[model samples]
Target: MNRIALLAASAAGLAVYAIAPAHAAVLPTDATETVTSCGNSRLQAGLATRVCAEITGTTVEFYGRVGLAGPPSPGGPAPAPRELLTTLSVEVAGAAAPRTQFTSALFTASNLEVRGTADTVPCGSTVRATFGVASYPYAANPVVHEVTVTC
Candidate 1:
C-alpha cells in the first residue's frame, strides 16, 4: 500500500511539471532612428519630395517635405530670373497643433536646402532630418539628392 501511494504522488508531481509554463528570454529594446528617402514627383513644373524618419520601438513617424515651387527660368540677357521659394512642413504621426512648417526665403532653381532644429522632441529621443532637391525640365526622371542630419 505504501508503494502504491508513493507511485501516485510521483505521477501527480510529474503532471504538474509537464503543465508548467516555460520562461522566454527577454529581448532588448531598439532605440535607433532610421531615415529613408521615399521618392519624389513633378508637380506642375515643381518637385514634390518626401523623407521618412522612423523612431525605433515606437510607432511614431516623422514626415517631412519641401513644398513645390516653379522651376527657375532665365529671363533674358539683362537680368536673371529669381529662384523659387517654398515651405517645409513636418508633422508627427498622430498629433496636431504642434507641427513645424517654415517657409524659407532663400531660393534656388535646381537645389533646395533646409536647416533647422527640432526643439519640441522628447528627451532621449532620436531626431533626424533629411533634405533633398530635384531639378525640373532638366533631368529625364527627377531624382532627389538627399542629405541626412542627426540631432
Candidate 2:
C-alpha cells in the first residue's frame, strides 16, 4: 500500500512538472515599444485615466482613458465619485524629419489629435505627454510611461 501511494505521488509530481512551462514569457525588446499609465493623485479628484501600450515589431500604439465624477447632491459636502468617461487609442509613428543624436523621436496621432516624444534608454524607452488635454481641468499633466525593449 505504501509503495502504491509513493508511486502515485511521483506520477503526480511528474505530471505537474511536465505541464508547467519551461520558461516565463519574455517581454519583447527588439524594435518594440511599451507604454504604461503614470497615476496621479491630483487627477483623481473627479477624473480617472490610464495609459496602455502595445508593440509589434517596430510599431507602437498607445491608449488612454478619461473619467469624470458624477453629480453632487443638493447641499451635499461631497460630490459623487468619479467614473470612466472615455478611452482613446492612438498609433505613434516616427516623424519625417531626422532625429537628433541622443534625442527622442517625435510621434503623433492626428486622428486622436495628440502628440508625444519617445526616447530610448539602456534597456527600454520612455514616453512623456499630456494626451493633448493639458488645458482641461481633469487632464493629467505630463503623463509618462516606460517599457523595456531591445534597441
Candidate 3:
C-alpha cells in the first residue's frame, strides 16, 4: 500500500496496542539502533532494532534487524515496527547531489531485517557514503548516517 495508507494502518494498530497491558515480571521498553558501522541499539514497546553498514574493499555490507527487547511475555502483544523506508547513496566528485543506489518499500514485522552489499564508487580512495532508515512505532528520528569509508 501507499505510505499514507500504511501510516493510517499503523496508527490504528497503535490504538489497539495502547490498552494491551504488557506482561511484566519487571517491564519491557522499546530498544532501537541507529546508523553505525557496527550498529547501535536503543526503541519503545519491547522491541529492539538495529542497522549497520561497513565498507570492505570496494563494497559496503549492511544489516538491519528488529526483535523482542526481552524474553517473550506470556500474554503481552509486542508491537511490530514499520520499516518505512531504507536508502543508500554515494557522493560523486563535484556532483550537486549524491547518487541513489537503493530504496525499499514499507515492511512490517516483529523480526524486521535487511542485509546486503553495494559497490562503492571505487576501491582505491575514500568516499562519502550514507545509509538511512525511517521506521515507526518508537523511532525518535529517521537515521541518516554519513561516514567516510576507505577501501
Candidate number with greatest TM-score: 3
lDDT digits (tens) for residues 34-61 of candidate 3 = 2235435645333465655555444544
What is the Cα-based TM-score of model 1? 0.34
Give a tens-digit lDDT track for model 2, residues 42-121: 24323433454455443444444444333446686653333222323222123233222121222121112122234333
Measured with C-alpha atoms, the lDDT of residue 98 in candidate 1 is: 36
Q: How far does residue 55 in candidate 2 sit from its true spot (Å)?
A: 0.8
Which sequence of candidate numbers ranks them by lDDT, best first? Answer: 3, 1, 2
Can you tell me which runs of candidate 3 are displaced by over 4 Å?
1-37, 44-47, 77-96, 99-110, 123-140, 144-148
- The predictions' CA RMSDs to the true structure, in order, are 18.4, 12.2, 18.4
TM-score of model number 3: 0.43
- The reply for model 2, stretches above 4 Å from the true place, is 1-26, 29-45, 69-140
Any residue pairs clashing in model 1, and if so which? none
lDDT per residue (tens digit) for residues 1-151 in model 1: 6999999999999998778433211122244654333434444224555554433343334443545354435663422333333333343324354334444343333344444343344433333333333333422222232222223
Clashes of 3: 7
**Per-residue lDDT for 56 in model 3?**
45
